[model samples]
Target: MASVQPKTRTFAGVALIDTPLVNAALQHARAIHDDMSFNHIHRSWVFGALIASKLPNFAAVDLEVHAVSAILHDLAWDYKSTFSTPDKRFEVDGANAAREFLGREAPDWDSRKRQLVWDAIALHTTSSIAKHKEPEVALCHFGIFADFIGPAFPGGIISKAAFSAVIEELPRLDFKEGVKQILCNLCKHKPETTYDSFAREFGIRFVDGYEVPSELERILNALDATAEV
Candidate 1:
């Protein structure tokens, strides 16, 4: 809920909500590693949570569970490998770790809430499961997709050219209308075995014109430059 002054320029025209969950998640994510380099996976989750929080549908969703799940979805990355290529085993491993950590630290959490958090984390990466069965699951799926495919962050794996191509093909892409179609297909159709692989092989390939603000671009460029050095 507290606003931190941006060390860099902020996007003025964007309708973005920096929720407490997002802020907390960002802090937790940054603390997960000493490098301080941005984690696209974590960034994606944070961005997704931010967008979801703004929607009227999110109000009906469980905030505590979703927030915890969103923040900890990739906590294993803190202990394992980077987001460019995540280990499926490590993601499952991270879910266990996240549940343990949350259970210990967040004592007020009830069993149902805890299960929701765990289920959300467990399923965050996989798409084989149906979105309609669970509203939180659907939301988490949508949130992650929106963040990865949306224009909040620059320098994502999906290039501008590819993003354009995907948008152009959206009308023809074989699935139901909207984000659900993409998620369902990615989960059900792809035989790559893991979400990371599916994303690398197919997800990033189809995307195109996500509007990256100049300020975010500058920050991303600076970060990339810093990483290179």
Candidate 2:
């Protein structure tokens, strides 16, 4: 919640996380997201970059785009947002917000680049889809998953010391609670939008009388109608 200077991270003399544009995006994100979400975004970029560096053709990775995507991926979860609407999924809200910001500030980035950032943010929470997209998308998806669920892939890629250094810089204080609160708010304000999405589970668990029909129920109803026919 407290406004803090955006932290910087560099790789091979290239500014990955602290470029002027990235800092500007961070400023926008920080204005809405609390410290927990802000720190998580920073760590997600670092983690994604680390994974990207391990790829056979690492040169293809675009750090600037990745930084922007990771920074703005959770913007919809912010308590306050000028970009959010009631009917859209939180991911789409974030994707649209980032796209709008880029369109206004970096007109030269071209449509493909903007879509790359949009896909990474919109599909970051979707594992099956995001993993099949571009390397930037896959890295961002896995990086966020790794941060929340622990390293699920080849572990030796990131040394313990390196991991500790990142955590030291951006401490993960109250992140779980902060994320829970965001999910709760989504269910509270937009229960209809959560149906068939990841947030549905959170809604079912947190919101009173919030229920979606189970898959088995649908199948049984289909069978009963078939027997009557």
Among these predicted structures, which one has the highest TM-score?
Answer: 2
Go through the candidates in order and give the C-alpha RMSD of each one to the true structure.
Answer: 17.3, 7.1
lDDT of 2 by residue, 1-229 (tens): 9856445667432235567788888888788776788889978887777777676644577778888899899888653567778889889999999998998878889888899999999999999999899977877897787677544456666666667777777888987877787887888887766776788888788888887777798689999999999
TM-score for each of the candidates:
0.49, 0.82
Q: What is the C-alpha lDDT of each candidate?
A: 0.50, 0.79
Tell me how far the alpha carbon of residue 1 in candidate 2 is from the true structure, in angstroms, after superposition: 46
Give the Cα-based TM-score of candidate 1 against the true structure.
0.49
- Model 2: lDDT equals 0.79
lDDT of 1 by residue, 134-168 (tens): 66666666656654456433335334553343334
TM-score, cand. 2: 0.82
Candidate 2, residue 188: how far the Cα is off, in Å: 1.8
